[model samples]
Target: MTDIGIVGAGAAAAAATYVIDGALPDASITVFEKSGGLCGRAATRRRGDVTYDYGANYLKDDDDRVVDLVSTFDDGLVEVAGDIHVFDRSGTVSEGRDADERKWTYRTGLTRLAKHLFGATDATVHRRTRVERIARSDGAWTLTDDDGGTRGPFDVLLLNPPAPQTATLLETADWDAAARDDLLAATRDVDYRTVWTAVLGYPFELDRPYYALVNTDKEHDVGWVAREECKPGHVPDGESVLVVQANHEWSVERYDADPARNVADLADHAAALLDDERLADPAWTDHQGWRYALPESGLRRGARTPAEDAGCYVLGDWVAGEARLHAAVRNGLDTGERIVHAR
Candidate 1:
């Protein structure tokens, strides 16, 4: 049986896991995730009875394969039906950028996308298991966790971390120096944009024609403000939840600042943009800081050459050169197929 080891249980990793498991049913696939959650930045959270996707608002219906995958497996799938308004740096809101196609989400949130893909496979996923060291011996790969525990000489190893983090691993890995240098250099060339998000909950309803407000000019401190109430089961009746994401500049500036202050500032920006004073102070708030949230550029062509030669593969949205969730899934699918064919 083929033995596969993967690090970081993101969307691409989950997609790869599903495809690999299906192709080789008897294969033993093991996954290590540093965090307790799956799907990486396509994150979700629950506060009492409320559930919201604070990271990625919704998946676009642009890709047929992703659309088919979600529709086929996610029974709780729900489409977001309202238009998205544009908010400028001047705090003016206008409606002209409504999406042509539907925005899809689920009752349980975006994390369900990963869960569905992984649930179908027999792969064993270990959460909160941080793999700190990577080593190779006799043409086989092994991983060492933070607790000094080692994972194994597997036939194949897949890396699903962001480009920068993946570069760090390659730098410290006890593998071929020339191959590692090539991969690390290529990975270092991949750029990323950070994002700081704030989730605000209000007891009263927000009477807005649009479900979200995005900054078209890219000059605003607040990049996006989306309403969770637009999703079917995200918010309760008569209550509204707004997810406010700061722009790249704002996020980088205050990434190391206090959480409470950042949340308040985002709420203030939202209040001015939405023309509602009530949004300035939410009843309750949740916050997340994504240091390497979105990839600005894709990996270089030669980057994967070295890894592939070493019986190692790296796949993610960044590798696919797109920050979208669909791209990550597609990358994983293609990577899985490549691994299967190579075997």
Candidate 2:
């Protein structure tokens, strides 16, 4: 039987797990996720009667294969309502920038995408188990977690954490030193944009023409502001939830600042852009800081060949050269196929 090990339970990892489990029915698959959550930055949270996707706004219908994959389990799928409008650094809103494709999320939230994929697999997933070390011995891979526990001695290993985190693991791994160094250098070269997000809940409804606003030039302090109420079943009737994300520069500056102050500042930006005073003081607030939020660039071509040759694969949107959620799933599907064929 094929023995497989995977790290991270993001969308890509979940998709890979599903594919691998189906292809190799006798495979013993294991996964370790650092957080209690799945789907990485496509995260969601609920408070009282409201559910919001505070990380990735929505999944874009850009990839045909991913669209087909998601369509197989079409339950709870909901389209995000309204057009996307553009905003300039001066806070001027425009009507020209509507989406060319559809935006989608589940009635529950985006995390359901990962859940549906993983639920079909027999892979044993260990959540809140952070894999702190990686080692290769006896032609097998093993992992050491934060709690001093070890897992593996598997024939194949898949590293699915962000490039930086994956790089750190590779740098300290006990494996073929030359191959590890090559992978480590490629992983470390990937740069990311940080994002600090604030979710504001208002008791009153917000009347707006667009579901979301984007900073086209990337010069604005607030990067993107999305209306959570536009998604079906996300918010209660006559109430609203706004997700405000600060730009990379702004996020880096206040990433270590007080949470209350960051929320207040982001709320002020939202109020100014929306031209509504009530937004300046939200009824309730929530916030998240993503240090390696969006990958600015991907790894060099064929840089992972050495590792892949040794039954080690790294998959994600960054590895696919696209920062979209669909790209990550597409990469995952392809990676799973590769592993199956290799066996």
lDDT of 2 at 244: 97
Cα lDDT tens digits for candidate 1, 67-92:
77777886999999699988777978
The regions of model 1 sitting more than 4 angstroms off are none
Clashing pairs in 1: none
Superposition TM-score, candidate 2 onto the true structure: 0.98
Residue 38 alpha-carbon offset, candidate 2, angstroms: 1.1
Local distance difference test, per candidate? 0.91, 0.91
Q: Least lDDT summed over 10 consecutive residues: which range in candidate 1?
A: 95-104
What TM-score goes with each of the models? 0.98, 0.98
- In candidate 2, list every pair of residues with a backbone clash: none
